[model samples]
Target: MNDVVGALAGAVGMSHVIHDAAAMVPYLTDWRGRYTGRAIAVVKPGNTRETADVVRICASARVPMVPQGGNTGLCGGATPLADGESVVISMARMNRIRAVDGANNALVAEAGCTLAAVQQAAEAASRLFPLSLASEGSCLVGGNISTNAGGVQVLRYGNMRELVLGVEVVLPDGRIWDGLRALRKDNTGYDLKQLFIGAEGTLGIVTAAALKLFPRPRSSATAWVAVPDPQAAVALLALLRDRCGERVNAFELVGRPALELVLRHIPAMRAPLAGAHDWHVLVEVADALDGAALDDMLERAIAGAIETGLAVDGAVASSLGQARALWSLRENISEAQKIEGVSIKHDISVPVSRIPEFLQRARAALTAMWPDVRIVAFGHIGDGNLHYNLSMPGAFDNAGFVARTGEVNRIVHDLVAALNGSISAEHGIGQLKRDENARYKSDVELDLMWTVKRALDPHGLMNPGKVV
Candidate 1:
């Protein structure tokens, strides 16, 4: 171990090779604080070459390697195992914007660049990188690609899988496969870069990427709409899409309990409507045309929905400040929930048309088992992903409820399976859901995944005990 650490220090500076136990705490834990791990060292490589060198050193020593970026993963995917037999490769020092090609509608960014930085780079070029998330300020590009992250803007722009054009990865054998092609069309061979994206570092370490960009929207409209139930919210989404076409940028669902938590724990958050509603949606529509009548169009469509009973009440943003205020209410739910207390959280997804059924049946099943369970549900209803969480009003009761997470998961996941939904929507199958994923995936599917895993990581060293 000492010899391997010395080799790692030689590859990158001694200062970058963090072997001290106390100094390695942050790299060893996950974002949620639900998982803590141990490592031989946390190595911060400055560039692709340095990252490859570090991987070679670890591979030569036959030590396991854990590739981590931003460490903002909720599923413990970035956290190392407790065995202290691995080297954690942190991508923080590799932050750089390689290029911005306005004509090509693409940008090349190093893996360590924050999601916000990527968005800003595109904005500077008068283009848009539309993946918007609550953790955009802190989460890194590599982590997003690894998880195939989906955000609110997915309704218009799609997720990381669609946004990423190509990737540069350091394979398990310490070989760099540069598949950073920026072409929009390629059909000569298998789409290789996709194998690494959403693989959770089990195949290799993503060093950088060529990402797609879009024309920036000049005219926009934002609204907070009230609905009587999930079914009405789903119907409202369909109506808006039909009326607005592809101009709908985001359609987020916020349940009553989700809003209450934000209002109670997040300071200065107020309800958008006058009366308490069981459900609400944050809708945004935008267009690149400068003089587009997006505001009036949304207003008219929303008015029509109200008359048809799709929406009960609504508040449309009149100014940029109002739009931001409306967005803040939806974005702060996770933070407020954290402050409120621990809860069993699930990032599940069904078809957009089946979202109403999922929400209704999931709540019914959960509430029946734990009569007092507080179900806080909200997410990208446009994309059919929901951050459904279960908790209790008091900490005392919540503790007992949390202990039954496995039981709760069985019921929720079973329903998701019945509805042909995924157990994990954006969050990767880290240690948190490894078993659950295996339980849900078909035998043939698992077999194919293992085949790919063994082909790339024959020694089972790259991010061991994760994904497949």
Candidate 2:
């Protein structure tokens, strides 16, 4: 192992190879602190060539490799297992924007580039990269692609899979496959880029990507609407889309508990509406043209909602500060929950229309079993993804509640499966949910996933103990 580390150090310089236990601690643990892994050495590679060399070395030694980006993942996808033998190939130093073609509405960025950096580059070229997440400031673009992240704007733009035009991946065998083509109409053979987009770094290491960009929105409107219930919020969403069409870029559903959590933990974050509401929807609309009167359209649509009893009350943002304030209420839920206590978080997604059913059924089933369970349900309702988290009971410790994770997951995931929903949504099935995910997937689907892993990785060296 020392010889192996020595060779890696020689390849990418000793300064970048971290073998010190204290220095490597940060890379070994996950962002959520749920997964703590062990690694022989954490190698920082500067470019694609260096990454390939590190892969080649690890492959020749038959050692497992865990390709990590910014390591901002909720799941333990970037964390290695407790084996203490795998080498972590950190791509932090490869941050670079290779190219930006404004006319083509595409830009090529290195895997190590932060999502915020990519968005800034798009803005510089008068385009929009609409993948906006709370961790965008720290999460790398490669990790986003690997997980196929779906964010707040997924209602209008789509997931990371749809936003990406092409990828440059270094295969498990240390071979580079540069599939970075920025073509909108490429009906070529296999669509190889799609394979690695959401593979969770199991097949290969993505070093760069060609991402799709949209025209920048010049006018925007944001509103905080109080709905009677989840079903009513769904109706309100439909009304907004009917009146405003595709301009409705974001539609988030915040439950009372979710909002209360934010208000309790987050400082100076007041509810936009006066009285308490069981459910709220944060709707945002935008247009590419300036002075498009989006707020008026939103106001009129919200008026129709109020008339139909879909929404009981509402508040529209009159300025950018107010818009951000409204958005902060929705965005601060996770942080507020963290500050409160440990919880079992689920990133599940069902059909857009079936969201109400999922929520109703899930809450009834959970509370029926654990009547004291604190449910913090909220998320991107437009795309059918909800971050349904359950906090520890008032009398119980976090460990006690977390000890029943298997039992809790069974209840939640079984309902999700019944609703034709995904057990792992946005956050990939890293080690945290790897075995739990197998419980819901069909035998045929699991076999097919394994087949793809074997077909690409062959030796199961890339990100072992992750996904399939």
Candidate 3:
């Protein structure tokens, strides 16, 4: 083990190879603090070459490797096991913007660059990178690619899987696969880049990527609308999409419980509308052409819906600052909930058409089990993904509520299965949901996944106990 550590230290500088328990503390835990692990060392490789060399050293020593980005993953994907035998390869020092080609509408960014940095690079070139998340300021592109992250803009621009054109990866055996092509069409024999984009570093480490870009939205309109129920919200979405076409980029739903948490916990955050309703939506329409009257179109659409009884009332943002403030109401739910207490959270998705039914059934079942339970529901309703969280009643404490995790998961998961929904929507199946994922996957699907995992990493040395 000393020889192996010495080789790794020699590959990268000894200062970059961390072995002290105190120094390795931050890298050993995930952002959610639900998982904590131990590692033999946390190595910081400066560039692609150094990262490849570190991988080679571990590959030769028959030791497992965990490729971590900004360590902002919700699942325990980046967290190592408690055995304290593996080495963590942190990508922080590999941060760099290799190139930007406005002609090709693409940019080559190193894996360690923050998502906000990538967005700024595209904006500098007068182009747009549409992947926007709450953690853009801190989350790295590599982790976003590994998880195929979906954020608010996913309703129109699609997820990270669509925004990325190509990737450069280091295989489990330390072989560099330089597949970063800027061309959109090549008639390639196989799309090999798709394999590692969402593999959670199990197949290999994503070192860099060529990401797709789009024309900047020159005009946008945001609104906070109150609806009678989820059924009406769904109908309104269809109506807007039909009237405004693809300009409707974001359609987020915030239930009353979810909004109340933000209002009660977050200071200076106000409700956009005058009255409280059971359900609300934060909808935005955007266009590439300036002076497109997007605001008028949005206001007209809401007015029409209100007349037909689909919506009760709404508020449209007249300025960009107002739009951002309105967005804060939706974006601050998770943080406010964190301040309140621990809860069992689910990032599940069902078909858009069955969203109302799924919510009705899930609520009925949960309330039947624990009538006083508090349910907080909200997320990207346009994509049918909901961040349904459960907390204890006013009378109970957090630990007592968290103890029902297993039973709650079984109930929620079984209902999702019956509705033909996915257990994990935007978040990938990491260590937190590895076994839960296996329980729902078909035998054939599991077999194929294992086959691919073994083919790419036969020794099971890449991010062990994750994904498959």
Candidate 4:
């Protein structure tokens, strides 16, 4: 281990290699603080060549390697194990925007570049990168690619997998595979870039990527609408799609409890509607042409929905500031929940049509099991994903409730399975959901995953005890 650390320090400056237990704490823990790991050292490589060199040293030493970017993962995928035998390869120093091809509608960004930086780079070229997440300011592009992250705009722009044109990865054996081609249609052989997109670094480490871009939207309309129930919210989505077509950008569902948490914990946040509603949705529509009448279209659609019983009350943002304020209410949910207390969070998704039924059944089953359990539900309902969380109001009981995470997950994930849904929609199967994933997946499916893992990382040295 000392030899390996010395080699890494030689490859990338000694300042970039940190072995001190105290200084490695930030890289050793996860964002949710549910996991804290130990490492021989945390290495920061400046570029792709330096990254490849560090990997070569670790591979030669037969040491396990964990590729981490930003360390903002909710799942403990980026965190090392407590065995203190692994080397965490932090990509934070590799942050760089290599190039922007305006004509091709693509840009190349290093693994360590923040999501916000990439968005800004695209905007400078008069194009748009539409992967918008609450952690965009701090999360890195490599982590987004590794997790195949999905956010609010997935309703229109799709997930990170769809947004990526190609990738540059360093294989487990220290060979660099430069597949960073910003081409739209390349149909010759296997789509190798996809193997690492959501593999969580089990196969290899992604150094950089060529991401797709889009025409910037010149006009957008946002609305906060109160619906009678989940079914109504689902219906409202369909109605908006029918009337507005592909202009619909985002449609988020927020439960009453979720909103109340935001209003209570998030500063200066108030309910959009005057009356206390059981459920609400934040809807957005955008177009490329300026003065495209998006507001009028959304207003007419909302009015029609109310008349037809799809929505009870609605408030459309008349200014950009108002639109941002409305969005803050949806974006601040996770932060508010965190401020309130620790809770068991499930990021699951079912078919779009079955979302309502899943919500109804999950709520009923949970309440029946624990009558006092507070259910805070919200997510990209437009894409069928829901952040269903559970917590007790009292601080004393909440700790005990968190201890029953396995029981709560069984209830929620079993229902998600019954509804033909996924246990993890956007978040990868990190250490947090590894057992649950194994429990839900079929033997044959698990076998195929293992096959891929063995084929790519035969030694199981790339991010051990994760995904597989």
Candidate 5:
């Protein structure tokens, strides 16, 4: 392939090596334009020693290597397979931000920065980088630590593998592994940055990170409730964490066909509450103490969850533009279910008391096998995670509801593995759940994930096929 695109355009230079198939068409598709492939080039590399010299010339031309970022992956794991051999490595030009420290709250960055520029460099150092997302302005903190990303403050700061701490990676023999270490206590031996944070890059190339930072809440509260299902939104998220204790930062559930597809395609989305019920949660409460009585602790916890019935109506955001218009009806239900079409997304995760018995057995086994299917449930029910999508009813035809997405992902990943959940909770099985994660993982968890992908990609050549 032109000597591996002339050694990745002589190691990151022919203007960041794109090899025109129309400038490698947006790093050859993903971000749910599902997958697309073919790549004899796409390189970009502007740091970590030119991404370890383009992974040592594609590990000496054995070729394969995918590691993309900000391709906003929803499981094509930054696409690239249909056997175009491989070579994507586009960490959005290693967009730097290299250090923030603010008395060791920690920051470092660069694995192409934007998780909203590391939450605006942890709010310009007054700190707080609680990985909030809905693609925090185009995902990338190395694809949110290569998909350890679970957002909506993972119910207050946790995941991006616990707000990372270190990782530099490069490995598939091009050896770099700096293990960044912005130390928040380390016991050393084999922490190995939790095997390249979420190993979606098969086991290498994360190029930068140190992460972790917090303390910027300074009082907040936002509500939206109206429940009566999903077990009264998990009993009003355990009665707002027992009357707002750890300051419940985000609970989020939103159903009623994901708020009627964000009030029919989100332009001035309304309905905070006036009728439709069937479930909705969207809670929030933060602190760090400036003006501390957070709106009288969100009006005495929504008047004691509507006098103990666990909320059957609520509203609370008297401004921050009505708490961003009640978080734009739960962040515009995945852009109005991508303009009302092609849906069959799963992103599961159970056991927060099995999320109302996994939404009543995945909506009674997907409406008893597609009986005019159209679930469109919602997510982060305070972290039992669900985006359990489907969409097709209104008299179907979005290519027959995306041709029944493999029978609606085998009845929603076989009832999310019978409630042991997670066919992929924070979207990272790429190649759309790699053969359904090899039939729901476990040949001893896919042989200890192929023994850590043959101990750091022993020639599987980085992101080959993907995730293991």
Candidate 6:
């Protein structure tokens, strides 16, 4: 172990290689604080070459390598296991925006660059990189790519996988696979870049990426609408799409319980509507033309939805402050829920058309079994994803309630599988859902995933016990 640490220190210098328990403490725990592990050392490589060298040294020594980014992942993808035989490769030192092609509307950025930094770079280049998430300030692009993170704008721009055109990765064996071609079209053989996009670093370390950009939206509109049920929310989404077309940038669903939690825990968060409704939809539209009559468009769409009985009540943001406030309510759900108490959360997705049935059946089944459990369900309805969460009823002890997480997960995940939905929507399987994934995934699918893992990382040195 000392020799392995010495080799890593020699490769990246003593300053970059941290073996002391104090220095390794922070990297040992995950963002959610659910996972804590011990590592032989935490190595910070300056660039792809250094990263590759460190990986090579570790591989040769039969030492496991866990590639980590900003450590803001909800899943334990960035966290090492408790084995204490792994070396965490922190990518923070490789922070650099390699290039920004304004003409092509693409940017090549290192793995350590925060999502916020990438967004700022795109804005500076007069373009848009629309992957927006609550953890944008701390979540690194590499982690986002690894998890294939889906955020608020996924309804319009898709997830991290869609935003990336190419990737530069260091394979598990320490070879750099520089497939960073920024072309819009390339049909040569297999699209190898995709394999690592959402592999959660189990296959390789994503060193950098060539990301796709879009024309910046010059005008925007936001609205909060109350719907009778999930079906009505889906109908409202269809109405907006018919009226506003591709301009519908975001469409999030906020359940009454979720909104109530925000209003209760998050100070100064007021209800958008006077009375409570079973469901609420937060919609955003954007366009490239300034003074593009977005307000009128939003008004027309909302009015149509209301007239058609799809939306019961609505409020369009009259100012930027109001827009921010509305978004705050949606974005702060997880934080607010955390403050509320221990909750069993599921980041799930089904087909857009099947969302209504999923919610209906899931609610019925869960409520029938656990009558007192509080279901605080909400999320990106446009993308058929929901942050379906469960909290203890009334005065139950939070810790005791949390102990039933496994039972709750079995119920929810089984229902999700029945609906042909993913147990993990935006968040990767990571360590949190790996076992659940195995239970839900088909035998053939599991075999293929293991096959891929074996092919790329035969030694099982890269992010072991994650994903496949």
Residue 432 lDDT, candidate 2, scale 0-100? 84
Model 6: CA > 4 A from native: 394-396
lDDT-best of 1 and 4: 4
Question: In model 3, which regions exceed 4 Å deviation?
Answer: 395-397
Which window of 10 residues has the lowest lDDT sum in candidate 4? 288-297
Clashing pairs in 2: none
Clashing pairs in 3: none
lDDT (tens digit, per residue) of candidate 6 on 331-355 = 9999998777668889999998888
Give the local distance difference test score of model 2. 0.91
List the global CA lDDT of all models: 0.93, 0.91, 0.91, 0.95, 0.82, 0.91
| Error of model 1, residue 84, in angstroms | 0.9
- Model 4: per-residue Cα lDDT over 33-142, one tens digit each: 99999999999999999999999999999999999998889889999999988999999998999999999999999999999999999999999999999999999999
Question: Which residue pairs overlap in candidate 4's backbone?
Answer: none
- Model 5, 48: alpha-carbon shift in Å? 11
Candidate 2 lDDT, tens digit per residue, 38-146?
9999999999999999999999998999989899898899999999989999999999999999999999999999999999999999999999998889999999999
Q: List the residue pairs that clash in candidate 6.
A: none
Q: Of 3 and 4, which scores higher on lDDT?
A: 4
Clashes of 1: 0
Q: In candidate 1, which residue pairs clash? A: none
Give lDDT tens digits, candidate 5, residues 39-67. Answer: 88788888988888888888887888888
Tens digit per residue, CA lDDT, model 1, 241-269 = 99999999999999999999899989888
